[model samples]
Target: LQTIKNHLVEDMFASEGFRSDLFYDVQTRQNIVDVVKKNGKLKVNDATMTRCDLLNTNGVIHVINKVLLPDHHIED
Candidate 1:
């Protein structure tokens, strides 16, 4: 759906990537790059990266354990 498409950002696979992009909240700021790099696994914020590089008609989907919100901040 067009609504879904607008909600998603395909920059996760970009050269610089959207790992630690900051977002503004109520005239405040937050760091939404709480990504965790373990052994070889990646977890963004509190959502663990379950899958990646999935084939989608529109774009790729990176599965995660939790539903990520627009809150800024990511684990270092």
Candidate 2:
């Protein structure tokens, strides 16, 4: 489970598109790490217990987790 989580984090870092974004940038990665440190629930170590969603944002509103994270990119 931990291995899967590690792989997912590595994949996110490896993704060129994701790495280019400001919102999902290095700061966000650090924020996620901080969140996990502060809250155990945010730490995802198993595929079955973990999910992610990226939503289109308009100004301040961004919907996420309506369902599981889409395997493909969400059209902006």
Candidate whose TM-score is highest: 1
The alpha-carbon lDDT assigned to residue 36 of candidate 2 equals 21
TM-score of 1: 0.54
Candidate 1 accuracy as lDDT: 0.49
Compose the digit string of candidate 1's lDDT tens values, residues 40-68.
Answer: 56666555677776767776677777755
On the 0 to 100 scale, the lDDT of residue 52 in model 1 is 71
Deviation in angstroms for 48 in model 2?
21
lDDT of 2 by residue, 1-76 (tens): 4322322332232122232222221223122321121122222211121333443232222122332232322222
Give me candidate 2's TM-score against the actual structure.
0.16
After superposition, the stretches of candidate 2 with alpha carbons farther than 4 Å from their true spots are 1-65
Per-model RMSD to reference = 7.1, 14.6
Each candidate structure's TM-score, on Cα atoms with residue i matched to residue i, is 0.54, 0.16
